[model samples]
Target: MKRFFMLAFLVGLIVSGFAFKVIMVTDIGGLGDGSFMDGTWAGIVKAAEEYGLEYEVIQSKEQSDYIPNLSKAAEEADVVFAVGFLMSDAFFKVAQQYPATYFVGIDFSFPEEKNLPNVMTFTFKEQEGSFLTGYLAAGMTRTGKVAILGGIPIPPVQRYVIGFEAGVKAYNQIHKTNIKVKSVYANTFTDPKKGKEFGQALISEGYDIIQQACGGTALGLLEAIKEENQKRANIDNLPEFIDDLYKNGGVFMLGGDIEQEWQAPGHILASAIKRVDVASYLGVVKAYTGEWEPGNVELGIKEKGEGISRMPFTKGLVSNKLLAEIVYIQNLVGIGKIKIPSTEEELKAFWLKGIEIPF
Candidate 1:
């Protein structure tokens, strides 16, 4: 009878051990940003479903709420995820306060001074994916003009622009085409009006393909493209406008961060996908399975953490030959054959290496 009771007690312990709890603390964008926040939440949900873990999220309405929300999540959950680079300071503070709990920071790189053992960070090589998008845009642009829209002048967003410019330069070098690339920063991630205004201005200036790295603000760019397409539908004999529209069924907009091909079917050229969901889900799984460790995890095309999406829409729009070239570039980057520029210094060095810039 004692043996039977001991076995039952051990079973109960095992069951309880499997029931891990996770909590995500979102940045000021909150849950409905339809870009970064939503993508991270999708990973959390996937982890919960796959591991049978309980999960909760605390959405911050403003910058001031970051610390409190992260602290609250750290206290309540076995593993806490502070989503977005904006919460890096708060996450570091909370992780230092609670050394016993595991903390994960998405899109964050920990400073060398604050190297906490219990804290892990996941950062993506967004430039690699953006490079592919720029390559595709250069190939698909009929007007020889492409543009990039950024949410803010942060490093992560800058990486996208830098890589995009490199890809365009590389394409121009190989094809002897003078493709012009323009970039703009909205200074806000949530303002769709600003996105629309900038997008419209670019469209009027004969920029046919616009790639957006802004968060929710990108939705406005898509809306502008749709509205412009409708306005020009009745205007005949406009070969320049017609050629731009014919290249990809309409003015092309490349998506960033998440798989946004579904956001606009034919209008979306491709998405530079940063797999935050994969990172978040894997982080939670590791914590739950006792494999969690402290360090920086940099995911890139090699690790399937970031790449371009080949959704049905993209497959239909992008040619097989171009897709093959994009894949080749992806593999080259993954294998260290192609070095993508991520910083200002590196970009300058790249340009100095006999790469022509169309400006």
Candidate 2:
């Protein structure tokens, strides 16, 4: 009996040894925000099922949790993925200690360092997707006025804003339209109060649709839009806080970084998605399967790694003619026929072409 028990134990150990171990440390927003971390988790779960990998996830409650989480994962995991730009410093510190364990940093870039051979930094061309959203907003707006709200001026955030404005100008010039756009920077990524405040301010200024580029701040923007809905039912004069001097119905919000259309259903028109899931998934698969490559991997509209999502909420809401035009543009942009502007000069030239907004 003793000999049989020992043999069974040995067989179990052998089976467990085949499982690849992965540990993930998520951003401050944690698992339930229905955004990047959630998307990454979905992909990880798929990999876990397919590859028989043992995996664990740790949520960072604050920025301070980053380094500790990284260190913990490095000690146990064959490969560890650190999500978000907020964790960059933490990752750098942990990487120095765990020189043997592989590290994947999503939405981050690092100076080339041969000594940190185990660290792979992945950054996305979010502006590419933002450009599509901007073009669509320009084409669809009926008020001849649109706006953008950015959480902060970080390179990633700034790129989205720049690219979006450029796309708007491109479509406007092609159609010979003049649509005014107002942009505001909230200067903070996590505060919903500032997002909502800026959103209300934009609406009062005659901006009808505002694209929000902050994380939690975007959620606040949505809240402000909802408040606009409540106010529109009451009076012609909008509050000073929400000084919109024009347009009849409530204002709308567009989300960035993730598929945020579901956040407020009808309130959020579309989302410029950065495919954090695909990025995370690819990283895990590469590491697990021995296909991992160092250096930068950029995903954009051309690569199908990022794009805007216009789900059914827009059906019947946007005019058929406008929808058709957007579809045509989408195909063109996707196929490289319509080169969406990625620079300030490119955007200005596109708008100079004078393509007008449908509204």
lDDT scores for all predictions? Answer: 0.83, 0.74
Candidate 2 lDDT trough over 10 residues, lowest sum: 238-247
Candidate 1 residue 22 Cα shift, in angstroms, is 1.1
How do the residues 1-359 of candidate 2 rate in per-residue lDDT, one tens digit apiece? 99999999999999887667888898775676556677777777788778888889998888878888888899889889888777877887898788787788888878665337777777777777877778778876767788888876776777788877876776666776888877679887677888888887888777878888777777788888877766665444334223332234446677777778777655677788888788777878888888877656777777777788865454445557766766666666677666655556765565323233344
TM-score of each predicted structure versus truth: 0.88, 0.84
Mind giving the per-residue lDDT tens digits that candidate 1 earns over 155-219?
A: 88899899888878777766778999998999888888888998999999999889898888887
Candidate 1 to native Cα RMSD, angstroms? 4.9
Model 2 Cα displacement at 102 (Å)? 2.0
Specify the highest-lDDT model's number. 1
